[model samples]
Target: MKTTNAYLSKTVNELKPSGIRRFFDLASGMEGVISLGVGEPDFVTPWTVREAAILSLEQGYTSYTANAGLLELRQEIAAYMAREFQVAYQPDSEIIVTVGASQAIDIAFRSILDPGDEVIVVEPCFVSYSPLVSLAGGTPVHVQAETEQEFKISPKKLESAITSKTKAIMICSPNNPTGTMLNKEELQKIAEIAERYDLLVISDEIYAELVYDEVYTSMAAINGMKERTILISGFSKGFAMTGWRLGFVCAPKEITAAMLKVHQYGIMCAPIMAQYAGLEAMRNGQDEVEEMRKSYRRRRNYMVSSLNELGLSCHSPGGAFYVFPSIQTTGLTSDQFAEQLLMEEKVAVVPGSVFGESGEGYIRCSYATSIEQLQEAIKRIRRFLEKQTS
Candidate 1:
C-alpha cells in the first residue's frame, strides 16, 4: 500500500470538511426530521422554465454548445441583467455561463489568486469562500461582522483587515445564513474602499432577486466597479432552479478573458438544457419570481415572529430565506442546540458556527420551506426550548 503523502500541500491539508455537511448527514438517517438546514428554496422551477428545458431537449439542442455557453443564452443574461439589475455587459466577451454560482466562485478565485495573496471575506458568510480561496493558493482573511450590526460588514471592519498583500474581497449581498443585504450607501462605501486599495471585488449576488425591502445593488453597477468587480449570479435562488446547475459571471474584459480559459479547462459550460431553462427564466419568468419572492417574505415574517415569541431573538432579514436567531438562552452551544432539536424534536436547523467563528451562539433556520412546515418547525423548537430552559 502506498504510504500517505506527508508532503501534502498545506492548503489542502489545512482545509476542513464543510460544517453543514455533518448536520445534514446526521439528519439524513432520521426518519421524521423536519429539515430547515438546507439553503435551497422550497419552490420548484416554474412550469414555463421547466417547459423550456424540455423544449430544448425536443429540439435536439442536447449537444455542448460552446465553452462560454450559447450566444443566445448569454444575450438573454445580458438583457435580464440590464432590465432587472441595471448592470451592463457585452455578453460575448465579458460573460461565461457556469455550472452554478459555486463554479463561478471557483473560477474567479482561480483566475485572480497567487500564493500568499489575501482575499478578505466577511463572516458569517457562505461556507465555501475560505476553502476556495485556499485552493487557489490564497489566504482567506475573515472579518467578523457582529449580529449587533445586523450581520452587515462595515467598511471600517474591512479597512482594518486589509494589508499590503490583500488582493481581493469577496462580497455576498442578500447573504446566506444571515440574510443581510448591503444597502446602496454600504455598497458605495465598499466600492470606494476597493478603488482606494486597488482590490478586486468578487461580488456574489445569487440572492439578488430575493430582497424584501431594500433594492439590491450589484457591485458592478456602482460607479468605478464595473471594471473592478466580478459579478456572480445564478438561477438557483431566484428562479428556484438549484438542481439545474446554471450560473454566470460578468467581469471586465481582461478578467473575463482570464476566467474563460480556466472555465474551458475545468467546466466547458453549464448544462445545455439548464442553459435553455435559464434563458427562459431571464426572458419570461418575472411573474414566477415575484410570486416566490412574495411567499418567501410571508414565511420570513411568520418565522421571525414565531421565534421571537418563543424567546429566541431573531433579526428580521431583508433578503434571502434564512433567519439567524440567538439560541444562547437555551444554554446550549449552537451545534448542541441543532443536534438536540433534530434528535429530540425531529426538526433540523443549522448551527451558526457552521458558517464561521462569528456564528456561534446562533442558529440558522431556512424559511425557504413552506409556511405550514415553518409553523410546525417553530412549534417543535418552542417545545424543545421550553424543556431545555425549564
Candidate 2:
C-alpha cells in the first residue's frame, strides 16, 4: 500500500509549515524560557465577553447559525465598523462572520483567485499570507519593504510589481512580525495603485485597536476603494478573544456572496457561542481594548529603547505589539541569533528571516507579554549579549 505521505496532495506536501510555531514548540517546555515570540495578547478575555458566552450557552444557543452567521452579530459588527473606522458595511449582504481572520483571508482568496492568479504580498508580514494565497491556487508575488521605508511598500515598487496576471494586493497595516503601520497618506497611494490596476485589495486589520501613535484608517473608507476592498478583522487581538475564533469580513455584496458559498460548504458558520461573545465585544469592549493598547504601548517603548541601547537597532513601532530589531550589528544571522539566545539565556524570539527573504538581518520581539515578563526577558537578553561580546 502507498504511504500516507505519498498519498498526500502535492499542494499539501509542498506547503511550508509556519516558522513561528516551530520556535514556539522548541521553547515550549524549557525552564526559564522567556518567549518574546508568539503574537497573541497575553490578557484573558474580558469578563463581560466570557459572561456573554456563558449566558449564550445557558440560553441553549448551541445550534449552528446561518452560514453568514447570526444576523444580530453581523449587525453589531456593522455598527462597530461604522463607529470605530467610519466605514459603513451593510449587515445583511456585505458582511460575514468567520472562524477567525485567518479563515476570512482563506475564503477571500478562494473567492477571488483562480489557478495561477498572482497576489502581491508585502513583507515582512505575517507568515500565513503567502501560504494562504498559494493554498487558494494563487501565486504570491512578494514586494520587499525595508526598514528605511518604515517597512511600508512604496507606490513605485507596488506599481512596478503589477502585471497582466496580478489580480489582487494583500496588505496588513499595524503589520505583524513588524509593528509598522501605514498612515492615511501611505494608504491613499496604495489605493491609487489598486484602482489603476483594477485589482482586489485584501486589507487585514486584525490589530486595528492596538495602534499607539495615530488614528487607524480603514482602506474601505478610502474613496473608490470600498467597492474593491475585502476588509478582514476580528475580536482576537482587540478583545483578547483568540480562543473564541470569531472574526469577520466586510466586502461588497458580490464578493461576500462568493466568500459565503465557500464558508457555507467548509466552516458552516463561526461558532455560535463565540458569535455571542463577539456580539458583546463589539457592543461593550472599547474600554478593555484601550487598556490593552496602552499596556502594549508602554511595553513597546521600553523594548525598542532597550534593544537600541544594547547595540541592536530597532525602529519605534506605531502599532501592534512587536518590534523588529536588526541583529546585523551582532555579526550574527537572525536564525543564529535566535537559536543562540534561546539555548544560552532562554530568551526566545522569532527570526525575522522566517517572515520573508527581506527579513534576514532582523528578529521579531513581541511585547504582548506582561511588563514584568518583558523586563525579565530584556535582562536575560542583555546578559546573553554581554557573554557574546566578552
Candidate 3:
C-alpha cells in the first residue's frame, strides 16, 4: 500500500487550504444560507456568446488547436484589449491563452521564478497568489494595505517590500475582496518604482469591465512599464463565462514565448469551445457586458451604504464586486464574525484573514448576489451585529 507520499514535496504539503472554501462548503449544506461569499458574477453567459460555443461544436471545431490557442481567438483578444483598455499586443507573439486567469498566474509564476525568488503581493488579495508562488518555488512577500487608504497599496509601501531577491510585483484591480483600484497617478508612481527596481509586474485585470467610476487603467499602458508588465485577464468575470475556463496573458515577446513553452507542455491549449465563446463575447457581446457592470455597480453602492449605516466603516469600492467592511465594531475576530453570522443569522461572508494576516479586522462580502439577496443579507447581518452588541 502506498504511504501517501510521506515525503510529499514540501511546497505541495505547505499549501494552506483556501479560507473561501470552508464557508462555501458550510453554506452549501446548510438550509437557507444566504451566501455573499463567492466573487463570481451572478449572470448567465449571454445568449450570443453561448450560441457561438454551440455553433463551434456543431461545426466540428472540437479538436485542440495550436498550444498558444486559436489564431482567431488571439486576434480577437488583441483587438479587444486595444479597443477597450488601450493596450496593444501582437496576437501571434505576445499572448498565450490559458485555462483561466488562475492558470495564467500559475504559468507566469513558474516561468519567472527560480527557488527563493521573492514576489510582493498586496493584501487583502485573491487567495491563489501566495500558494501559487510557493508552488513555483518563490516566496510571497505580503504588504498590508490600510483601511484609511481604502486598502490600496501606496508606492512607499511597495518600495519597502522590495529587496535583491525580489522578482516581481502582483497587482489586481479592481482588486478582489476589496474592489479598489489604483488611479492613473498611482499607476505612474508604481511604474516608476518598478522601473527603478527592475521588477516584473504581473497585473490581473480580470475585472476591467466592472469599473463603475472612471475608465480602468491598464498598467501596460504606462510608458516604460509595458515591456515589463504581464497582463492577465479573462472572460470569466467580464462576460460571465466562469465555467468556460478561458483566460489569456499579454506580455513582451520574449516573456510571452517563455510562457507559451510552459503552456504547450502542461496545458496544451485552452478549451476550444470556450475560446470560440470568448471570441464571440469580445466581438459582439459588449452591450451585455455593460448591462452586467451596471447591475454590479448598483449592488455595490447599495451594499456599502447599508454596511456603513450599521456603523461599520466600509469604503466605497471603485470597481469589482466585493465590499470589504471592518467588523471591529462587534469586537469579533474575522473568523469568529463570519462563523457567528453564518450559524446564527444564516448569512455567509468571507473572513478577511482568508486573504492574509492583514485582513484580520474585516470581512469580504461579494455583491455578485441579487439585489433581493443583498437586501436580505444586510437585514440578517444587522440583526446579527445588534445581537452581538446587546
How do the residues 34-120 of candidate 2 rate in per-residue lDDT, one tens digit apiece?
889978999999999999999999999999999999999999999989999999999999999999999999999999999999999
Predicted candidate 1 versus true structure: per-residue lDDT over 292-374, tens digit per residue: 99999999999988989999998899999999999988889999999989999999889999899999999998988877888
lDDT per model, in order? 0.91, 0.92, 0.92
Question: Considering summed lDDT, which 10 consecutive residues are worst modelled in model 3?
Answer: 1-10
Per-candidate TM equals: 0.98, 0.99, 0.98
Candidate 1 or 2, higher lDDT?
2
- Per-residue lDDT of candidate 3, residues 271-383 (tens digit): 89999999899999999999999999899889989999999899999998999999988889999999989999999999999998888999999999899999999999989
Q: Which stretches of candidate 2 lie over 4 Å from their true place?
A: none
Q: Candidate 1, which segments miss by more than 4 Å at Cα? A: 5-10
